[model samples]
Target: MSKNLIYLLGSGRSGTTLLATILNSTMQIHTLGELHQVYSYIKEKLKCSCGERLEDCDFWKHVLSKMELTQEDLSTLSQAQNYEEQHRFIPFVFLGKNASSDYSKSQEILFKALASEKSTWFLDSSKYIGRFLLLKQLKFLNVKGVYVIRDVRGVIHSFSKKVQTTRGPLNTILYYLLTNIFGQICAWLFKDVVKIKYEDLIENPEETLHKVYALIDQRYDEIIASDFVMPHIIGGNRLKSNKSIAIKKDFAWKKNISRPKQILYYILALPIMILNNYKV
Candidate 1:
C-alpha cells in the first residue's frame, strides 16, 4: 500500500468522496478530495462555503503556503476542523476545471510529496480519469484506482442544480454522457481498477466496501466502526463550487428535478445506448 496510489474515479455526482472519507479512516490511508491541481494549481477569490472568499480565508492560505505538510497533518486537521474548513484544501477547492487537465508537472510536485509522506495508500477522490491516465504515464506504475458509478439520470439531476456550473440542460447531459462513456473507456484502459455502484454501496455497504477495500490491497482490520454504518446525506455547495463525494437518499436527481430536465436527460443520454450492455 505504501508504494501505490489509490484513485476513486467517476462522474462528478457519484459518491467517490464518502468512499474516500471511509478509506481515509483506515490505517495509513490518506484520502485527498478533488485534487485537480495535481496537474495545475489556481488561486480563486471565490467565497468559502462559510460565506468568505477562499483568498481571505486564513485557514486555506495556511494550508497552501505550508510546505511539505504531511498526511498526518491533513488527517488530524480534517478530523478537528468543521467539514467546510477541512474540505477547503481539496484540489477543486484550490484549483478547479470543468475539463480534464495535463497534470504531469503537478503530479511531479504531488507524488514526490506522497512518496515521502507517511501513508500506506494515498487516496484521490476526484471524478476524472484523465488525471489518473496522466499520472499513470509518469511511470508511477504501482497505482490502485476505483471507479464509482451512479445512474445517468441521477448524475444529470445533480449537475443541473449545481451553483458554479450553469451549463444549459442539454450541455449538462452531453457532459454526463461523454464523461461516463470516457470514464468506462478509461476503466477498460487502466490496470488494477474496480467499479462500485453508488446504489449498491448504499444498499449493502459492508459487502461492497469489503470488496472495494480489497481491490486497493487494504485489509479489513484497518476499517473502523464509523465506516461501517454512517447514514450519509448531501447538501451545501462548496464555498468554492465543488462536487459532492456522497450520494444520499434525498438526492434522487431523477425524482427531484423538473420534467423538462428529465426529458433533457433522456434525450442527451440517448448516446449511452452503446453501453446498453454496460452495467452502472
Candidate 2:
C-alpha cells in the first residue's frame, strides 16, 4: 500500500465525485475517479476524460506500466464470477502485493505507482462498501474512509433520472436503504472514518473539507480550496466536465420527486434513514 490512500465509501449519486474534484484542487493530492472500475476500463476500452483511451492516456499508461498490469491481468480481474471475490482483490492491488493471484499483484503495482508520483496523497473514490472490508485485511495502506451520504430521496431522484434501470421506485428505495445500511456498518468498523453528509459539503465546502483533512491527518490548504481546478480524472459523474468550481446544494429532488413518492420513500427508507439521522 502507498501509505496515503483515502478511500471514499458510499452509494452512487452521493457526491463522491464532487468531493474528489474538490480534493484534487490541491497540488499535494491527486484524486482518481471511480478507479474501482479498472476492469470496466479494460472491458469497454473506455476513454479517459482527457479524450484518450485508457491504454493511450499518458497518465494511465504510466500507472499501468508501473503496476506491471497487462491486458490479460485486467481481463482476469474482470472475469471473477463473484462480486465479493472481485472486491476482495482491490486492497491487495493497492498494497502493491506480489501475491500469487494476479488481482492482488496488479492492484499493488497500480497504487504503488500512484504513490510514487508527485502528489503526496491519492484519493480513490470508488464508493463501494465491499472495498472497505477488503481494505481491513491490508496493513500497508495508510487508509481512511470518508462515508459520503446524501438524503435517500435525493439519491433516488438522481438515480431515477441519471441511471437507466428497469427497477422501480420501491426497488430504488430498498436499494438505497440496504446500501447505506452497509455503508454505515463500514463506517462504524473502520478507524478514522469521516461520516460526511453531501448536503453539508455543498452548503459549506470549506468547513466540510477541513473536517475531512483532519480525518486524513493532512493540513488543510486554503489556497488550493480557493483556486480549485479539476485534475485528470478517470471515470465519474459527467458533471466533472464543468470547469466551474462553484459549490451549491442540488435540492432539485425536493421539487422533482412528487410529494407522494417522497412519502413512500420515507416509509421504505424509514429505518436506515432515521438511523443515519436523515430527516423524514
Candidate 3:
C-alpha cells in the first residue's frame, strides 16, 4: 500500500492542531503532530499527548526500535533536519534538491515505521512550508497540503498570551503575513492542496473536512466525537492532551486585545485578510 501524507501548512495557533486532531478521529488516519519536532522532544524527554515522556512512551519506543536509530544517529539526524528546515533551504527544496540526504533518509525511515497496514493516511501538522516543499520532492509517498488560515486578530491575541517567548503584535503580524502569503503560493504550486479557514472549520466542521478529504480522494465520515484519545503526537499546542474536543470559536481578541494593536494587526494583515475574505 502506498503511504499517503497530509501536511497542514499554516502559522502557529491557526487551528492546525485542531484540524489534525479532528482528522485523526478517522479510522484510516493517524495524526503525527509536528513530526519535525520529534528530535527535540526526544532530546528533551518531552511529554507526549499520551501522558508519557517521549523516551518512555511505548509507541515512540516501538517506532525508534523499528527504525533502529541509535543516540548518535538521532543527534546526526537532528542536525540534518535543522539544516533542511532553515528558510534558506526552501528554494532548494522547491528545485527538488535534497540539501540534507540524512534528513530525507531519516524521514523515509520514520514515516515507514509510522505507516501500518490499517492506517495509510498520516497527518503531519508541521506547519512549515520548507518541510512541506521538501516532502513533495520525495517520491516514496503521496503528499497533499492543507493551507489553514485564521483571522489575524485571533492569531495575534494567541501569540500575546503565549507563556513561552511571545512574538509581540508587530512580529506576530509579520509572521502571519509571510506564512499565509507563502501558504497561498504553496496552494498554487500543488494541485492536491486545499485551503480552509479556521472560522469555517469551527463553525462547520463536517463541510470543511469534506473539502479536505476530497484532496486525498477519501470519503468523509462523521468522526468528531465528544471524547477523543490524544494521539501519540510529539509537539503541538497544549490542547493536544485534552480528551474532550471543543469546536467553539474563540472571540477573545475582540475584547482582550487593545484597540490600537488590533488596528495594527488589521492594517498589516489587510491584504491577506481580504484575499481570504475575512471581515473587520
Candidate 4:
C-alpha cells in the first residue's frame, strides 16, 4: 500500500522512453519500459534494450521469475477480454487477486520482490490511455501521471519515419488528435497529472525534471540526469538503445512535412493544442 506507481502516459513515440530514462536515473526509482506491450515483445521476439532476447535478458528474467510468471502468462494478458482488462490484469496480479483465468500467483511474488528491492517507486511508461484509466482503480497503491505532449506534426513525422504503416496524413493527424484528447481526459480525471512538453524536456531537462521531482515529492538530483544509463526497458521507441542521453529537439517535421499537412495537423489538433499552450 505504498505510493508505488508513477505512470508516464502519452502516445507512443512521444518521448515516454526519454522521460522514463530520466526518472529511472533518480534515487529510489525504477522504470519498466512499456508493460502493456509485453505481449508484443514476446510475439515479435524483440530483444530487450540490453541486446538480449527479452526472455534471455538477465534483468527481465529476474522480473519474470519474481512475478512467478512465464512469458506465456504475460503474453496471454494482452489477449484478455479487452485492453482495459489487460491493464487491470497487472494490478490484479500484483495484489495477488485474479481478475482473469489467465492470471497466476506470480503477481504477488513480483510485488513482494520489488518491495524488497531498494527502489521506493516504480515507473511504468505504458503511454496508453486505457492503462492509466485502469491504474486509477487500484486502491492499494498510489497512481500518479506525467502526460507528455509533442506537436502533432512531430509525432506524425516520427511515426511516418519509424512505423512501417502507410497511414495517410489526415488519418495520422486525426489519430494524434484523438490520442491527445484521451490523454487530456485522463489528466482531467486524475489528481496529480503533471503536464510535460516534449520540447521543454529536451531543451531544459534539469528544470523540467526538478518540477517533476517536486510534484512527486522526491528530492531532485542534478547528477542523475547526466549519468543516466538506459534500464532494461521493454517496448518503446528504439531510441532507448542509445548509450547516453542527448536532448535534441526533432523539428524535422517543420521542414519535412508539407505546409498543407502542417496546417491540417494544426486544424485538427487546434483546441487541444491551445489548451496545452502549443503555438499553431
Ranking by lDDT: 3, 2, 4, 1
TM-scores for all candidates: the values are 0.63, 0.84, 0.93, 0.82
Number of residue pairs clashing in candidate 3, backbone atoms closer than 3 angstroms, sequence gap of 3 or more or interchain: 0
Give the true-structure RMSD of model 3: 1.8
**Model 2 lDDT, full chain set:** 0.71
Q: lDDT score, residue 175, model 2?
A: 68
- Model 2: colliding residue pairs: 1-95, 93-107, 93-108, 96-108
Once model 3 is optimally superposed onto the true structure by TM-score, how far is the C-alpha of residue 210 displaced, in angstroms?
0.3
The CA lDDT of each predicted structure is: 0.53, 0.71, 0.83, 0.70
Candidate 1: regions farther than 4 A off: 38-105, 115-119, 162-168, 225-247, 257-264, 270-280
Kindly list the per-residue Cα lDDT of model 4 for residues 1-280, writing each as its tens digit: 4447788877666788888888788776788787666656655778888888876897876655555656575556546523444443444433544343332222234445454353377888877665565555555457778899888778878877744454566777777776777678767866688888888888888888887777678788665556678888886676678787766678888999888778878888888778887776
Clash count for each candidate, listed in order shown = 4, 4, 0, 1
Per-model RMSD to reference: 9.6, 4.1, 1.8, 4.5
Candidate 1's TM-score reads: 0.63
TM-score, predicted candidate 2 vs. hidden true structure: 0.84
| TM-score leaderboard ranking | 3, 2, 4, 1
* Strongest candidate by lDDT: 3
Q: Judge candidate 3 at residue 267 and give its lDDT.
A: 78
